[model samples]
Target: MNCEHAKGLLPALLDTALPADETREIETHVAACEHCTRELAALRKAAHLVKELPEIEPPPFFAKKIMAEVRAASVPKLSLLKRILFPLHIKLPLEALAAVLVAVIAIQIYRTVGPESLRPSDMDPPRAPEKAQSREVAAKKVEIEVGPYQSRTPVVSEAERPQARDEQMRAAVDKAGPRRAPVSKDSDKKGFAAPPPAKKAPPAPDELSKTSLVLEKKAKQSDVETPRASAGAGAAGFEGPRYKKPEEEKASKPRELHSDEIGFTESPPPAPARTVEAERPAPRKLEAAPAEPAPPPPAGLARETGADMALDRPWLDESKKAGAEEKAEAEERPRAKSAFSAPAASAPPQVVTVRVDERPRAGEKLLELLPSVGARLTRKQVRFDRDVYFVEIASKNLVALVGKLKELGTVGKASVDTAGDETVIELRVEILGRPQ
Candidate 1:
């Protein structure tokens, strides 16, 4: 074979992988060429040196350790079924028992004491007093008998009097006119029985307008007048500082607190008709409304709100300003270029022509390659397109012939045809090398 063929064979022979034909070629070349003979000798010597180099020594104890371990006692063997069931036999029953115990305890606890335990007790028995209650009942009876036009306060012994008198006094203060409010002395009794004439509530200045509007409507109705005789009896019953009058204004005292520390005796509830109805109805809406409003927040809530506002204001204001600035920028700023830039309009139909001097088409030069490589030409296929041709050629010589074809410009791509024992290859050609 040739020098290139010989070089290829030499590498294979050195690797000991050369086939028979290639091996014979290598041997023949080595025999005739002194240069090849020297190269082979040097290659052999290098390989020998590599093989002769001192072998790596393993650690001294490595072999002993490996042998000792391999000869060591074997593991105790169990049947495959026992191995598979071993873990489950120990673990599964314990898991099941734990699960069952947990379920039972959970159920028992749930059935015994439940989530409702977390709720607070809100129930309270009626807290009205029994002593003044009889007196109040007496007052209501007299009020109905007297047509409710006359006051029905009755004289009672000092021992029979309850701090309810203070409640009565406070009721009076609540009904007190623009005049100065009576200073109440339920100071001794924390709760007072509301006596409308005696009931006193602090009139908040702001609610005064609403109070006035309601007060005006109530004013049109008839008020009970004190009878001359009962008034004298009531006046005489008021003995010195002990019978002191109730303040006409309500204080911020908690109902429960007053009862606890102050022994506050709140007024007996107004008798349903004459003595009680008016006082009970008048302040309930206003006082209750304010108290309810405060229920919306805990005492610390206002400070918390103020703190939250303080914390948020800077960021909120900055963001708002930033948004405004961004808006301003958007309005006054230049429009951005489109991100895609319209894909360069498909590169503007750019046509670059390459100089291809010798290109084979459906022409006479193609006839030069026809016979040696074995080609069957179809005259009709070559007739129409100046750049196309058809031929039937064997695939064996296809690569070599195609290599020569490239030197003549390009042979676009070949179309292979199988007919009987022959294969056909068709190709398109371009005559003009540059864009016109």
Candidate 2:
């Protein structure tokens, strides 16, 4: 048999599974081929080693212990809802008992202090002295004669009647030019008389004109005088005290000194003034000689031909040179690849280009992430199309905020910019379908 066929039967031969003919053939091949002989010996050694190992029996109650551990491990974790509901079992009875106690106390309070306290007292009755006196007067009766008699009206002459008397008095008043009526002697004796009307004094033409002129003059004088007086007072208030030197005051008030008044033996003669001539050093020549025109700058230091005017524009000369080199290499070959080529293979785009697509909409996802990340949306704008949202968020913990935002939704686009000391995150969210 060939070496491959004999080697395949080696394991079966060790186990004594091969038939007599095949076993004899394998044995003959092993005897002649050194490789096959070594392989057979290795197989025999492996079998012997496996057989020599001692068998181990399990300890008592091994299955029970294993089953107990599995049951403990398999116990499901408690969810928020389960934990919340668990407390209701103990709380419901306690709450119900508390409510019952409150109701009982309310009912007892109502019974003790209710409508009975508001009712009027029956023990005391109201009393009035005036009412009692009126009742006493009403109780006494006065008898009246009830004889049947003819009723007669008093006869009054037309000329002697009160109507005639009133007309006569009115006519007399008109004829007398509003003179007072003469009171009867009986009325005068009774001490009752109407008072006389007061007379108004006649007005003088000259007095009215003089009074008006006097008032006008007084108003003009008051207006003119007030400003000058106020200005003088203000000037006096703002002016500072005049400061006189001590020597000048002493010269002005010179007094002859007596022997006893003089403190010194004699006044020392005034010292002559000495003018100081400081030896000022010659002024150092601080002005440097005009520097010779600097040698023309090196080529590297010289400004480039296509320098950007905007400060923010990055210097792309190195990148351009590298791209040119790559292009040259590609051109030298038969196939010249374009500088901007398609992606190498079919795979997810690089992290720099592609962003995660959050499943939840932008606004809701940001709200969910705010508390966990401890971030605030300082500024936000929602698009009219309801498909995009732009938000500016600030946070001290930038790492945590970025991490939470990634988990909140698919981050379509994210950028970090700084404003003063705070980090401002600008996010552009692409709204997807409604959340589940």
Which candidate achieves the best lDDT against the true structure?
1
Weakest lDDT window of 10 consecutive positions for candidate 2: 276-285
Question: What lDDT tens digits, residue by residue, belong to model 2 across residues 280-397?
Answer: 0000000000111321121111111111001001112222345544333222110100100111112111111113343335456666666665554322322222233333344245
Candidate 1 least-lDDT 10 residues: 332-341
lDDT for 223 (candidate 1): 26
lDDT of candidate 1 over 1-436, digit per residue (tens): 6555665556566676867876887889888877777777777788778889999889999989987776653322345557667887767888999999999998776543332111111111111222223333323322222222221111111111222232222223334212212212221132232222232222311233433433432331112222221322132222221122111112223211111211111223222111110111111111111223242122112212332223223323443455544343221111110111111112111111112443344244555766667754422121111333334355455565565565555655443222222222222222333222
Residue pairs with colliding backbones in model 2 are 357-410, 358-409, 358-410
TM-score of 1: 0.25
After superposing all C-alphas onto the true structure, candidate 1 shows an RMSD in angstroms of 42.4
Q: How close is every model to the real structure, measured as TM-score?
A: 0.25, 0.18
Query: What is the clash count for each candidate, in the order shown?
Result: 41, 3
